[model samples]
Target: MARKEFQHYEAVSAAVPGDGAYSAAIAVKGLGAGGAPTFHRVLQDQTFKTALAADQAAVQELERLIDVTSEGELMFAQD
Candidate 1:
């Protein structure tokens, strides 16, 4: 049987000094094995004008990283 897993993401604006453009901080939380949730920084200080845009970019990045195709197929990466 396949083990069940859960993931959650959050994006927030992180503006830096002298940089006119806005950046985003993306955080991910994973749950598995009925254990404590694990936290990770997927993306940090990524360029985005707004929180909504940053969120969209973060999702796209995650999809690409996980090899999710445009046709909605999920592919696992080979080691």
Candidate 2:
């Protein structure tokens, strides 16, 4: 997993098991009191042949993230 910290939250890259492959995902966690953690499934239309590839893609996606909502939602820089 790859982790990135923002002003009020943190983003993590993850690889999830898919059909004969791996899928990229992002997990966002809010910082400070009353914060929550949210898992966001990314790259739904793509699958990687290896977990490492998926994780790497996820890390790239995490880097693209601009911010996190108070509700633990993710805001990406682009679609």
> Global lDDT of each model?
0.37, 0.84
Model 2 spans > 4 angstroms off: 32-37
Candidate 2 TM-score, true structure as reference: 0.79
Looking at model 2, the pairs that clash are none
Q: What's the TM-score of every candidate structure?
A: 0.37, 0.79
Predicted structure with the largest lDDT when compared to the true one:
2
Which RMSD values do the candidates have, in order? 10.1, 2.6
Error of 1 at 8 (Å): 12
Q: After superposition, how far is residue 5 of candidate 2 from its true place, in Å?
A: 1.1
lDDT of candidate 2?
0.84
lDDT of each residue in 1-79, candidate 1, tens digit only? 0122223322222222225554432333232234432322334545666656655654554443443233323333344
